[model samples]
Target: MDNATAKNIREGLKADCTKCFGLCCTALNIVASSDFPINKPAGIPCVNLQNDYGCQIHSHLRNKGFKGCTVFDCLGAGQVVSQVTFKGQSWRENPKIREKMFRVFPIMEQIYEMIAYTAEALSYDIPYALSDKLSAQLKEMQSLTKLDAEQLLSLDLVMYRLPLNKLLTETSKYIRESLIAKLPGTKNSKNYNHERADWIGKKLRGKDLRAINFRGAYLIAADMRNTDLRSVDFIGADLRDANLMGANLSTSMFLTQMQINSAKGDINTILPTHIERPSHWIN
Candidate 1:
């Protein structure tokens, strides 16, 4: 898929809270931790959820110890359930179907996430065969999202996801190997050590971080402006308040909406086409 087409598909898969019924706030359980301030059961409505399905503390979630909310993205699942499956019938309005709605919400969320990942994988400069397979699978997963509530409930999602996951793994490997081959030195490049490193508030501007494994690295408040981060894996990197101005991460590996939301960025932060800048970021 071309960049523009892929971008449009990705934008369609983004969460639009205005079109949703606060599924994440109500359907999912919130436990007491550094991420969440209170404990709420799965079927219970969050105390911060307003009557119109809006989060009262939406702008202040992180400040109120609900940082988890800021990081959570359903990838347009909420609206799919609220608008398509339920046909604009909210659980609050239709109390009889509330239980079933909650049950189906999580399932749709997983499916949408899969679709988003698959679409993102197709956007990369991958081999034609892999791209074709991913594109076909993306269409299949997208069609599944349009299924009725009963069909979605009965879907063996795991079976459908296995092949897609395998293809994505292969794509990642191919992209990483291709990137590594183009680095400054074949063997002795200065790689970013991201294993539990304390890089909080450190200045690391304009560095080449391609294919670096940043799983669970602490990059809090780090100045990462103009960094070359192609193929860099950010599986579980903590980027809270990290500055990413002018950083090119359009082809970064395993980067998610949660990570982007947790970090600070401006107009100059060049992100992947699929991911959007956090709303609270300074322009």
Candidate 2:
């Protein structure tokens, strides 16, 4: 019953709940913070959780330190486990089954991964030549997603990830094709097109440049730690070797996945969009 490592990476972006059962919040103990109020035990609902299964303090989570809750995405692991596998008999409505729901939560997280991968495959704009093969893989992944709770709980995920990686490689190529092509032969550099001029290779730590359009500029080896870059457009900017430790760029925009992954960030760095800083960047 080993859970297969999913071949799809797109699932990480969109966790599907139609196929999930809300297992993580229901089965796990979300630590008490100013937002959640109560440090409920495993399988027990948070005091903030209402009868409708929504957090009563949803809007005020950050004011309380439940900041962790905002970033905790089950990747659609909850809904799929509850309604899809268990036939909607889990803890969303009935409180008595909380204990059993907690036990099944982790296993359900694994099972939802398969569905996650399948969903990613469907998002592709693949070449016509590869459509048939892609369709077959998608169908096979969907079938695995329908396994019962017992079967899902016993899954071995180590072996599952290998095939998923292979499938993801193909999907990624198609996704790239779906994006609007940039201008031909344009160097991948940052352009200070906005009122903010270029600052490539500048030693500018502790400088504040919030709300600037830094598109298509070269910021190689720039020292930008502890600076404010909130609401900056980093499209086509080359931030290779830029120091972003302890920087505050909250509420920034146009920082694509590639830019964030390429640039360094630690817990000390305050990210835009309320993302939790990485551990490495912690002070």
- Model 2 over residues 238-280: C-alpha lDDT tens digits? 7655788888766444344335544666677776442334332
Native-vs-model 2 lDDT?
0.56
TM-score for candidate 2, residues paired by index? 0.49
Minimal lDDT window, size 10, model 2: 1-10
Tens-digit lDDT string for candidate 1 (25-144): 888988998788899999999999999999888888878898889888898899989999999999989998799899899999989878877877777788899988998898899898
Which regions of candidate 2 are displaced past 4 Å?
A: 1-22, 29-44, 92-99, 127-133, 173-283
lDDT at position 10, candidate 1: 69
**Residues forming the 10-long window of minimal summed lDDT in candidate 1:** 186-195
